[model samples]
Target: MNAPSGASGYDAVVLGGGVAGCVLAARLSEDADRSVCMVEAGPDYGAEPRHWPHKVLNARALPRDDVWERHTAVHRIRARVLGGSSCINGCWNTWGSATDHEEWVRAGGPRWSASAMERHRLRAVEQMGLRAVPERELSLWARAALEAAEELGYGHVAMAAPGRPGFGTPLINAVDGVRWNAAFAYLDAARQRPNLTILSQTTVNRLDVRTGRVRGVELDVDGRRETVVADTYLVACGTFGSPALLLRSGIGPADHLREFGIRTEVDLTGVGANLSDQPGIFVPLAPTPDLNAALAAKEASGNLYVSRMLIRAASDLCPDSSWDLHILPSAGAPLFGSLPPGQYEAGISAFLMKPASRGHVRLRSADHSEPLDIDPAFSTDPDGHDIAVLRSGLEIVERMAVSAALKPLAGAAQGHPSRDLSDEEIRSRLGAYWHPVGTCAMGQDDDPWAVVDEEARVRGVSNLRVVDASILPTVPAANTQLPVLTVAEMLADALRTDGR
Candidate 1:
């Protein structure tokens, strides 16, 4: 753990160094008049080996240099560093559609209108210096996938070009082709501000609430207890951590918190509710005998492109109803859980989009140091739309395999060569897509269960706010990196206006 060796005081404290947390600190300190403090429980990503762009050459799992590992009946991975998960995730970026924000507004999160979010989205791209890629300039595989879709009569997809939806190459948070995490984009710049102080390796054990208002927080610093006080504090600790913090502070489903002997500070039953994420239905393909030479292409020349293909299938198969299919070209050697060597050395993988089922993040115990229970509630919802989409994705991939463009490279299917794979078979094989969201939601009205309001202020509490993925009312149809960054940018400006 990277501990801060100094005492600090600031007008506000931004907890968690992920995309939202870093942005909160950076944006708040922009005026140079107010002081801000940002703390992360993880190590620094700058000195880590896994963060190297070229390190992709190594097929082995990146070493857990700066991340923290927690054990339970189920194993989970978390980055305990200045950059949070951004330090360890693959550089796949996705921005939400306009409809995404409209839904939020409808869900009671005012000021979250699609147009409002677009303003922030533009600022986020400018902050990161991201240039839009022309669809025609996309790599061969990407072009082929697009072409294949057209041939199969599913042609309305877009590329990574600006202002397009459905299928476009992702806009990575990579600077100069290297991963550009939140700490790099916002926090690192904020660290240079004289009024901003960053305390690393410090974990907040609980919030110190007094008289139904937030006073400060309690911390477990290197196994020692410490109390922190500030005029205002923000919990950017993420969906899982944010709710867990509330539970430890005696806020949550009343009965659940009481069982642990922690008196309820606020009975917010929705604290850990509305959890969700996207899962995939993978389709493996091998290069044709002629393209074996292409399989040996240099690492520098190979890149993976992720785009979605909306599939219309039986609604009965999927109840929650929203779904999309992901397409990625096989770059080189086999990935985790590879099959026999002769398998198509290069191919495409697909995933179900906009899953309908929801999951929950809950406390296994009230102990701050204990790991929180995570059900991710995957596929438990019978009303979910992903089950149908997964089956549809299987059929679509099979259709592409037979297309003139993909057929030459993918060849005739083997084993079950009849393009007749079952939905159950697809479900059995595909895995989660890694876009988890919406544990700590923000809304208006009398919903005490909502942790925060439209302006990002924590409900029932003053001088505190939450600026992270947890506040997302609905997960976007695409990647979350861009949206998370946008939220940070917007909040930064909002905080400035509020402070004035």
Candidate 2:
């Protein structure tokens, strides 16, 4: 490994080159006075073989040596690149609503209200060049299904604020039919700054903390061990990586850290607790005789936005809820398996956004080389509210399937063949989207599990912070990418406001 000639230590070191890390690296280096170093355990975005826009094509194809093709779980998708999941995720963006941030505040995120979140969202969209465009009517299957949902009391939600609902939501990360991931939005700009340096394909094993202060880091690069010293450090390695790294570094619960023969830095019990993810349901649509020709004509053109249903989870069986509906214009290739050809396959996916169940992440071995246990403990929500919401979602599917506009596209229902099945059967096939949140939670000192404070500073530790989705006490009602970026944006503003 070759190090830069003058490279030594940086003013700030950002672990993980994912969306949040990229934003922080860019924003912190804006002043040019502070030197920022962003380290990614993945490959550079340009060299990665598979890209976000071509995910469908890759889905049909098998995996190769592409850095974007790393699977975090047995049957899940993860991208290990400079842009992290943004380099390989579906190009759909869900800018969370004001209520989402309000929920965050209630959950213990400090100094972050719904209004503050809105300002950050606006700034993010403006930077991404998300312009509203007219919806093209070529995809009849999607159009028909959306129309059916409307008739059944589910209206289209404009991804924009100000309460004007419409059919299309602007694609923030997609510019002129190309994928514009976080690498392009933040990391690319940061690369030009002399003070900002990015190191890729390096995995951080642990931290070097002395007297409750972060001093440096220990890393493994190409089968070699190296050390890096930094004045301040921030961990933005998403939900899993951050907590696992902290745990491996003996910065978690004192008892847990002791079992691994590592001395404890802090007894942060909530370092890897309160994990949550949304469940998903896909309803397919049939095609008309002219569907092929019509789709071909409008190829490279699409609504590219989600027309979602802000429905609740289930009956009030649980304090929290599960399963919110997302009426996307089109579905990506089947997440679970293959779909039969010649079917007009438009879909409405219902995600269990407000799930009552919770899970946690832990290290199976003290070894940093081993994969962490994801222990989602999914489908075990005590109230069974997730099942109930999905059942309601299934009823919605049935209603839309039989609608005047949708029946033509949905030639026949498969499961029950002649009739819709009972709620029990629908619950059987429901699954989850891979949006994980809340492992290293944020809260006040009064909170038993609070790992960091409102300003993202690690409690009991100086010059060490966590600036990622891991700090979210609870998952929001929308996709995590947008919210995570918004968190970084707000933090950046706070840092600037403090002149630190």
**Model 2's lDDT to the true fold?**
0.66
Tens digit of per-residue lDDT, candidate 2, span 116-185? 5678877776665554533552255556655665776644555544232223343445544455677777
The clash tally of candidate 1 reads 16
Give the per-residue lDDT of model 1 (tens digit) for 1-500: 34344444568888888768877877888878888777778654453445544542121123245555544221145567776666666555655545566668866555677666777887877776555444432444445666776676643533222233334455555543355566776665665668877777788888888667877777778888766667788888876788788778876788888778888877887788888776765566656655554433422353322222232222234323232446454434453545455332455556544566777888887777777777665555685456656656666667777787767766643567423655466556656666677777876676655767877776667787778888887787666677788887888888888882
Off by over 4 Å in 1: 1-8, 45-65, 70-76, 132-140, 154-166, 175-177, 300-325, 337-347, 412-426, 447-449
lDDT of 2 at 193: 75
Superposition TM-score, candidate 1 onto the true structure: 0.85
How many residue pairs clash per model? Answer: 16, 3
How far out, in Å, is residue 376 in model 2?
A: 2.1
Error of model 2, residue 460, in angstroms? 1.8
